[model samples]
Target chain A: MLVLKPMMQKTSAKYFFLMPGVLWILAFTLFPLVYSLYLSFTDFRLGKEPQFVGTKNYVEILGLDGEGGDDKALETATFSLFLTLGSTSMTLIMGTLIAWVFNHDLPMLRQMRAIITMPLFAAPIALGFLGVVIFNETNGPLNNILQGLGFERIQWIIDPWGARFAVLITDTWQWTPFVFIVVLAAMQSIPEDLYESARLDTRSNWILFRRITFPLIAPALGTVALLRLVETIKILDIPISLTGGGPGAATQTYSYYVYQIGLRGSFQLGDASALSYLVVIIAIIISSIYFWRVRARFD
Target chain B: MDAASSLSSSIQTTHSKPGYLPGTSRIGRYLLIGLAFFFTFLAISPFLFALTTSFKTQTDSIDGTVIPFIQYQPTLINWEQEFGLGGTETFKSLRNSALIALGSTLIATILGTLAGYGLGRFKYGIGNRNLVSWFMSQRFLPPIASVIPFVLLFRDLKLIDTLPGMVIINATFTLPFAVLIMRDFFADFPQELIEAALVDGAGHFQTFRDIALPLATPALVASVIICFSFAWNEYLFASVLATKEWKPYPMLVAGSDSVRGIMFGFVTTRMLIAVTVPVFLSLLVQRYIVRGLTFGAVKG
Candidate 1:
């Protein structure tokens, strides 16, 4: 009885500690999640009872109804894909380059690293506002510098492609440092002894990097790439502030489109909820692949 | 040669293995440094331009003024308008931001620490790995997925546009991150101390409150800084949930435009105000920022 009592106390004590967090998640996160899923099936609107429509929202969104229902979702999904691919590629390439540069034992490189990473911490929406100033077509410094360098000025904010480019630049600038920091850490973690042993066989630094550094850091790069891919798909704030989904919906990302449908302009809560689930599902699939692939690496 | 000298020489060779580029000359090193500095400038150029814009007249900013006193005259009009004693709106948002951020951070850190400690130390029949994954999956769930439910739920509870409402949502958003970090921290904690305390008759909570919590300061600090910064920088929920009374600084920054198509000078100041906390906190938590960001996948 005494031994059982102590075991019971220990077991209950663990639950006691976990109780608050579990309950909080139940009420705030899990409940709302299920509720939103419920809302997705209904024609939910503010001040109107959510009438269950039975897969109508999903069908219209998926165009299973055959009338090209919600073609806008397709358009926005395409834009989201473009932005995701563009931003992820640019961020990965630039981040790897910068991290490689900063990995060296150079003067003030640490300080340079610190300075470069500042953008990662800034709010994306705030960066979007800053992007407006930076990408200002007429008098923006970017175009000013281009013209000064004898290149034709690019219409950064007004044109569709230009606005898309601006969003890519802003998201890349903000997230590149994330890759930089993570990759830099990965690079630094490589034991010098590996290089020491490799140096016996090769004097070519390129070969050394290819043979020794690249393979070791490939996992880190892969992880950063996956993280960036997931994040860029949900790009909303930058488009909201930088382009306002302007230039005829050129910059309208999937999330921004979902926001418009759910919250703004007639408040189509059901459709928005349905759209949100699609994104959630996509994100889950991406991360699940990532986790499954990397599960062997983790304990 | 002595073994220590050989070891030191090997270390020196590793240290001197020139940068990514194959360069041994002093000129090459300096050139690499310069290139690095240029990239650094490119990274921070947005903030730099914004800082200059914050100090410039509206006309000066739109004129693409790059250098202060060279291309255009700078002024404090923007700052005076947004942050001077008369800027009640900005002040209210700042206050609301601090209160909401701090309130949410407090809740997330405390609750997360307790749960994280349990998850870290105890083995459960359900599996800690599964529980931790469940916690972390919440972090990746699209905010849009929950915003509707939150709006409807908060409306019924009279929580929309309230400080507590913002705090609750922000805390919920940041809780998963907090758990991931603190769980990793406690998992790596020294088991001897915990075992000793248990042998000495300290209850689980007692050992946690005294031994684990105090020793877990660095992780706690990292979690707190991360949670606060995330809560502070939040905008989507702020824009939707907070109409006027609980408007956060990000909304103020985002909404800083007039009929003149995005008042560049005013918006710059608002952005600077919005980013200062995060920029400073990032520096303070630089060591743990990577870990916190990657949800403890990286032990950095």
Candidate 2:
């Protein structure tokens, strides 16, 4: 039954299947990545030749060159960090609660879960457009509901803190379902007999969660948290749509800042490339930690 | 949750409920139910508001009238303006979006599946594990980092604002997701079938095509869904590359704001159109959502 193909023929088949993907990645990702790295070191613009400046762009973006450097980058970077922490924590806590609440068997839950998860797929830019109306100080449903509840109306889009809150809540609403779904899957994977045995030892729900549920689901939570953190750090679309970095740049995120410098304003391609590399560095650091932890668990 | 409580109460009034702990008071149960409903409302409220706003007139939209007939008269002017005869830009954008998304998804899925199958079934000089990790790292590369180079490159090739160009870049970023997920799927596939086919004198490609490909349909479909959505929702590259006649619908939605502030009626219509495309296709991917979202990390 051993109808053996030649070794040379087998190797040809492998390359025939694999070479297209490799070529595509080379043409699109690796070449452009290297090109952008070169761009980051030059003084490039839309209509001019790129002259290599050798770390000047990085120096200016890092605010080490005080003359031409902008402090706004630092400010936006801080805001981005705050937004990442704030929104990621909120998404995690809310996701844990919702997933825990819905972990049990229920009627129509399958359908409800589909509905709840819809926002995960919605376009963030579109959500931002809707946010303008939803968070409208006057004649918006959110403020109207708050007034009905005997709370003061907020200047959601106009005030600085309110604009920040608008971005935060919008992001949380969009991503919490991700955590919910992953955590729910994790929780459901715990053996039923394990929980049954634990119930025999404890009459308190909190104790059962602390002893059985939390430890079992902790890894899943950590993975989701880190994933959400990375995504949040790169946020650009919602701020573009919802606030447009308005109310005195209160909601300008780091990605938005990079876009402003590179594409929108002076078309500073060099600085933009440098800024982009900075983000890449941060992302690489975080993802490295994620890989180390997650790969260890999987192995 | 309510169902769990009822099952517990009906059983022996004991502490043996599998999911629910021994003691959840009636108020606690009610609170959980309340929280669930409230969150469910919060989850869909934006879409709900967009739906109503799509049907509202400019004045009535900002007037805070939510109900259709009682509070305000619903109108089709917004929808008509967008989907009707005067909506040439909208029509073109929708067509461009569909073409780009479909074109990229087709290319990425085919290429990714082949590479994934090769990686899964064969040994290579660079180990399959390292190759998979390389692809995964590509998935994490920030689009901003590449946008400038892409802009310059596309301009030089005269590929800017063209459907093929958009397809190339989108397929680039989305290709990683397809590769990673398909690799995971193929890795976990049962291998006895391949050996049987080989023993029957079928060549490797024949086995992969006739036997393995059919069995890998679910993974293929999942990869297709994910790649399609990522391309469809792509905005950054589209924003820079497609300047003129080839602009996608997301650009239209993001640029819907008029000089006189946001025309709520018009913006809402575009917003709904942009969102409905992916959300509608999402139902087909319900089972694959967790795995797809996490890039097949935590398999559902």
Candidate 3:
């Protein structure tokens, strides 16, 4: 009896320690998640009684069962995909190149690296605001520089393609620093002997980098790419702040689209809820692929 | 004689390796240095431009000049107008943002620390790996998915437009990150100190407060800064949940576009104010941030 008493007490004590956090997660996270799932099945909106629709919302969104799905959802998914690919690749490439440069001995390297990463620290919304100032048609610096160089001012914000480019630029500017810092840390960890031994064989910096540095940093780069994929698809703030998904929904991302449908436009909670579930499914698929790839590497 | 000469050569090579410069021409080195400087300048140019423009008058900000200080006198009209005595809306929003951020950060840190300790130290039938992974997977759920339910739930509870509402929601999202970070930190904590404290008959809470909490200060600091910045920078929930009474600073900055043809000076000033604390905090704990950001996937 006494032996069992201590074990029970220990178990209870652990639960006691875990109670607050678990309860917080339960009430705020799990409950809301379950509630959202329920809401997705019902035609619910603000100030309206929810009716059980039985897969109608999902069907409409997916275009399954011979019904035309929501075009907005498709558009949002396409935009998210494009932005994810564009920004992630750009950030990865630019960041790795810059990290490679910084890996060399340079004066004021620490200060310069810090300055380069400052953009990552700024809020996405703030970056969006800065995007506005930087991409301004006439008074902005980019246009001013163009004019100074005898070039015509491009309509950066008003035109559709220009607005999309502006959003991509802002996203790239904010996230490249993240990749830079991560890759730089990974690069710094490689033993100097590896580089020296490779250097003894070849005077070509390109060959040395390709053989020694690239292979060493590939794992870190993969991790960053996976993380970036998840984050970029769910991006909301930059699009909201910079272009407001403007020039007629040219830059509307997945989250922004969900926000618009769920909260802003007509308050279609059922459709929005279903839309969010679709997003969750896409996210899960991506994450599972990442996990599979990572596990394969380890094996 | 052959053995001694080889050993001496090996030592000399090792010594020279530390001071060895990679083979690059002087011009190439100079070019690389220039490129680094150029990129650095490019990264910070937005901030510098914003800072200079924040000091410009309405007319001066719109003038066709690239340089603010060179073209016209710098003025404090925007700052004075927004942050000075008359800017009640701006001040209120700032205060609300601070309250929500600090409140949520404190809650997330304490809860996460306790949960992390429990998950790290105890064994359970469900398994700690399962629990920890469950907590982390919550982060992967698109926030908009949960946000829809949160909007409805808050509306029913009359939590919309309330400071506590914002705090609760922020802590909810930030909790997963906090738990993941704190869990990793606790898992890495030296076992001997904890063992000694327990062997001396210290209770679990006492051991946590006296032994574990003190040692986990770096992680705690990282958690607090991350939580605060996230809660502060969050806009979606803040926009929906809080209205005129409890609007956050981000909402104020976002809503500024409505005030007549993109007021550059006003917008820039608000943006600078919004970003200053997070940027400063990030710079201070630059090393620890990667762990918090990556959820311990990539150690700093």
Q: Number of the top candidate by lDDT?
A: 1
Instruction: Evaluate residue B114 in candidate 2 and report its C-alpha lDDT on the 0 to 100 scale.
Output: 91
**What's the DockQ of model 1?**
0.55
What would the per-residue lDDT of candidate 3 be over residues A1-299, giving only the tens digit for each residue? Answer: 96786577678878877789989989998898889889999999878999999899998888996777888878878888999999999999999999888888788775677678778767788779878888999788888989889999989889988998899989999899889888877787788878877777888988978988899889889988988998897899999989999888988998999999889969999889988988888777877656555432111
* TM-score, cand. 1 vs. native: 0.94
By lDDT, is 2 or 3 better?
2
Error in Å for residue A189 of model 1: 0.9
Model 3, chain B only, scores a TM-score of: 0.88
Can you write out model 3's per-residue Cα lDDT over B1-300, one digit (the tens) per residue? 234234323322212212223538899899889988988998888888889889988888877554656788889999999978879988899999999999999899889988888877777577676676667667777788888889889989999999889999999889977887788778877879988987797877788899999878767777888889889899888878897798999998887787756888888888899888887666655665666676666655
Candidate 2 collision pairs: none
Global local distance difference test of model 3: 0.82
User: What is the per-residue lDDT of model 1 for residues B1-300, given as tens digits with 9 covering 90 to 100?
Assistant: 134233323322223332233344678678778888989999888888889889888767777657888887888998898878878988999999999999999999988999888888887677776677677778777788899889999999999999999999999999988888888888888989998998899988899888999878777877998899889988889989997999988888877764356788888888898998887676666667677787776544
What lDDT is reached at residue B73 by model 1? 81
Of the true contacts between chains A and B, what fraction does model 2 have?
A: 0.54
Root-mean-square deviation of candidate 1: 5.3
Better candidate by DockQ, 2 or 3? 2
Prediction 1 global C-alpha lDDT = 0.83
lDDT of 1 by residue, A1-299 (tens): 96787688899999998889988888999999899999999998887988999999999899898978788889999999999999999998998888777777787665677778799889999999888888887778888889999999999877899999999999999999998888888888887778777878888767987898889889888877877888887789999998898889999999999999989878889889999999999989887766655443223
lDDT of 2 by residue, A1-299 (tens): 23355566679888888789999988888898899989999998878889999999888877677775668888898889989999999999999999888776544556667778889888888889889878888878899999999999999999999999999999999999999989887787777788788767877778877888999999889888878988898888998899999888899998898888888868989888988999899988887867766553221
